[model samples]
Target chain A: MKATPARDQETVDKWEVQLRKGCLELAILAALWEGKLYGLEILRQLESDSDLIVSEGTVYPLLSRLKVLGLVKSEWVESEAGHPRKYYALTPAGKKRALEMAGIWTRFSSSMGKLLAPLGKGNK
Target chain B: MTMADDVQQRDAQQSMEAYLGRLRRRLRGMNDEDAREIVEELRSHIRDKAAASGQVTASGVDAALAALGSPEELASQYLTDDLLARAEVSRSPVRILESLFRWASLSVAGFLVLLGSMVGYFLGVVFILVAALKSFHPRTAGVWVLPNGADDFNISVRLGFGSAPLEGREVLGWWIMPIGLAAGCALVMLTTRFAIWCVRQYRKSRALPRG
Candidate 1:
């Protein structure tokens, strides 16, 4: 019996969602590792600083999740030109977790690179 | 700012408020503090973007909102993130209890809990209800003074159970049942309010953002 590989739009979309879901937490943590930024600022920074293109809506909730986990802390400071903005920064725990995640990500990506190298050369 | 610019800014501000209001309505079960934080952040972001693009106007506000995506989509994102985080955390009995309390009205959560093979929910419900009812049960400790030789009158405070006489002259401890009933009612009210409070606190504690 032969099994057919399903490459339907639904399947592709599912895969993409999973992929995005996995990386989003990492992207958010890394963005905060540099400095404090509010919800939208974090989204813009992620978009500009990395290959991660995220919608503004998703970022706020993710920030809430991170804060819940105690990996991030936020405070409101009155802006010079406008109202107070909730700026988020990494906690000590968050910094350690981010560092650990970065290390794991590095190894995983490097291993994936090696695994995909042969395919990359053959496609050329 | 000129009058025309003021009108444009006001129009833009109104649009932004409407957008945020829509978002707030979409985030129904979300904790109030978190919702407020989300709203304020988005507001500032919109204003900042508008300023960067030169003067706040309805068009600028529209563009900023378009970039953010729809309110429903945004709410679903928050919900997905919340569920994922919740799944990751160790489901201690307390957390599970809180979750059940939080989603008691939602059939989906009840279904999921049942599917998760946790018989503890039944135990939790039974425990909560029994405990609450027990509070209303009048019991007395120490001396319960009552009418002498009253065959119908008996008083015991053993283990939250109480006995009382119908009539007594020098009734020293005749007040146990009424006091117990009152205490019980209070306990029931407090228990319900505590359950609600626990759910809110759980949600609030899930993200305190240091502010």
Candidate 2:
């Protein structure tokens, strides 16, 4: 039926949202894993580097939560044009957590892939 | 600046103000420090976007706002992690009962330790009954009835039936009340420590990764 495609799309959209939510922190930590970036610059970097393009509102609140949990820290630094901007960088604990979580994700994803491989082959 | 440019800048500023106001209102439950930090970051983000686009106009402001998401969606993300964690813990009936037991024990233990007397024991028993009842029937708030004074503190309740009267009482002397209270205090402390350990183990199991 015509409703089937719409239902499928809705499910896919929900999955996409969940996937993004699950990995947003990982993406942010990965972005900051290299160096400190101002709030806007982090957004730009994420949009450029990956498929996980997110809104400014989304990133700021996440950053605030990370800061509250002591995983990230921010500082106001003068930009090239002389205005102050808040720059975020991972704390040592954040870096440790990121590595741990990434490792877990890698193993979990691999296991999922293996589990789904037979189904893919069957469809093929 | 030219009049047209001035108008454009005013439009941009007003849009930014409205966006920030929405954000502030949506984040009402958030603590002040975090709310202020988020608001400032958003403002700076808009300014940065505007500067990058080479002019501050209504369109540029709108673009920046769009990139940030609507205020409701944005605010919801801030609370999602905590809400998810709580939901995860509450998924199992075992966990819910565990939490209820923890609540009862901690309160009773606290009362026992703080007010080490017959009155404290009476109140603690009442509190535990109330908590257990509320857990089973969430809408009900259990009540306690006690006699007027500590000396007449008879831990008893009598309910009359059609043929026979049902009565419950702790038929112990007033002098023995203090000794019982002391023993209860010690038992509560020991049991609380053990309960906390068991709870931690349960939570650890719950938090374990699933295939």
Candidate 3:
């Protein structure tokens, strides 16, 4: 039976939602691990590197939560323009977690690759 | 400065101050230095926007305020993905339910204690016992009891050269029942909405590709 358009769209949305939910924490930690950044700078970097876009509303609460968990630390530094900017850097614990998440991603990708290898070879 | 110009400047400063006040309240519990920096940055932005408009009128101030949006909305834009993930983790339904249950239990217990003190020791003891039993088996006992029929209770009295009788005094009207039910339903709806909002925020933050 042919799937209706609405059903197909719903399936796609569900997969996208699952993928986003699964990777959000890893992405955030990885970004911070590279270097400390203020909110706007992080957004700019993300825009330059990938398709991901985040709003300040989502970022602030997340930062508060991570700070509570001791995964990240933040400080205020004077900007060249004389305004103070809050800069966030990864804590040691956060760095460790980032490494662990990266390992998991690598293993999962490899497993999926193995499962799809026969199909890839057949196509070749 | 002309009278009109003075008024315009005052309005602009007032609007900026009000917006900053709101942002500060929302940013409570952050490092003091960080909070101050955020305030300064926002202040600078408002000043720049106002200057760019070239006319410091009430309308220009309003325009700058509108551009900033509500404090909550602006603050959300500045949040990092890690913060969003943390918010999602804490917004669990189980956590909310646990908090609600605790609050309800405390309120009910306090009410019962106050009633018992005003009435009598025996009544208070009885209430405590009943509350304990109900709490242990909330599903079986229900949260509250309602009189099945109001018509059965009555009072009759004879005074000097007169007789009076009162009957079917409604302690709670039928309309009150629906109102209470609506209030309870609203509370549940609000809690669910908040949880959903937290989840959506988390997903949005996560979906943003990392640098």
Candidate 4:
């Protein structure tokens, strides 16, 4: 690893945190783009697919909010193994919103990549 | 030994119960039914996560609990989120203020909105009081235009306790009652609306302001 100042690293960490906070909703919604899943399943999916780790505590409350906004709906499904699991699925409005967000994200990332192209070349 | 494993297993169960107990206590003030539902759901999640690890040890369960953060923290998040959702659909001042108080714990924006509402409501009450008290003390319970005070000329609202000020002129006569009542009601209404507007704007994003 290259030597870097701790303060610089802290600043980078803060920006990454900000980025993660903004994308968390999209990430959760995208995870449900497949099908209904329980809380732990969502967590595992995010962990396996991306480095966008979140404290597990934040997920359920967010799911509740999404429900309130009519973006998602949940149901209690009985399980043979243990207690019933609460499975959440995106609603029609949620799917529409996710598509719109994904479009915006695609354009924004390409723009950012183009802007950073010079930096990449300089590093080489 | 089997005995040691039994002790560890008992300890693990106790830890989980203790954690759930703390969570239940923190979830107070929310509807009992809703709070109980949340706690049970969380309880299930913890059990499932812990079981997935294939160990029943205290450390294993604790790890699962830790992944969910502290009981208080999770409870507060749930409370804030619930309050905000309710506040969105509700026009009740009491309910809105309750939600703002919950949000105030997390963000500077929320704290400021709550403060503004409190100050507005306080002033509204004071205005109504001044108006109501005017009927009782017509002589002094009106707006006073003191041309000169100990420092500068001061305009004040007084309830006329002992003496109407030595040289201060009482303005508005009987009109003060109507003015005070109207102004009081207006302040209360304006404050409520402003607070609700702020709540609506901030509700879309719950992340704390740049810290």
- State every prediction's TM-score relative to the real structure: 0.63, 0.59, 0.49, 0.76
Instruction: Give each candidate's fraction of reference contacts reproduced.
Output: 0.38, 0.32, 0.19, 0.44
The numbered model that scores best in DockQ is: 4
Docking class of 2: incorrect
- Classify candidate 4 by CAPRI docking class: acceptable
Order of quality (DockQ): 4, 1, 2, 3
Segments of candidate 4 deviating more than 4 angstroms? A1-5, B1-3, B90-92, B100-117, B124-149, B152-211
- Which digits, one per residue and each the tens of the lDDT, describe model 1 over residues B1-211? 7898888888998989998998887666667887788888888888877777656778989988987787765664565455445645754444544445334433353344433424433333433443344445433332244545745555432322445344433222335345544554554444434443444443333322211
> What is the DockQ (computed on Cα atoms) for candidate 2?
0.21
Q: Each candidate's iRMS in angstroms?
A: 9.2, 9.2, 6.6, 4.5
Q: Model 2 off-target regions past 4 Å?
A: A1-5, A111-124, B25-30, B79-211
Clashing pairs in 4: none
**Which numbered prediction scores highest in TM-score against the true structure?**
4
Give the interface RMSD of candidate 4.
4.5
How well is each residue in B49-91 modelled by candidate 2, as lDDT tens digits?
A: 8768577678888987877677655654554432223334444
**True-vs-predicted CA distance for residue A36, candidate 1, Å:** 1.8
Query: Model 3, residue B187: displacement in angstroms?
Result: 17
Q: What is each predicted model's overall lDDT from 0 to 1?
A: 0.64, 0.61, 0.56, 0.80
The weakest ten consecutive residues by lDDT in model 1 chain B span B202-211
Q: For model 4, how many clashes?
A: 0
User: 1 or 3: which has the higher TM-score?
Assistant: 1
Clash statistics: count for each candidate: 4, 0, 16, 0
Candidates 3 and 4, the one with greater TM-score: 4
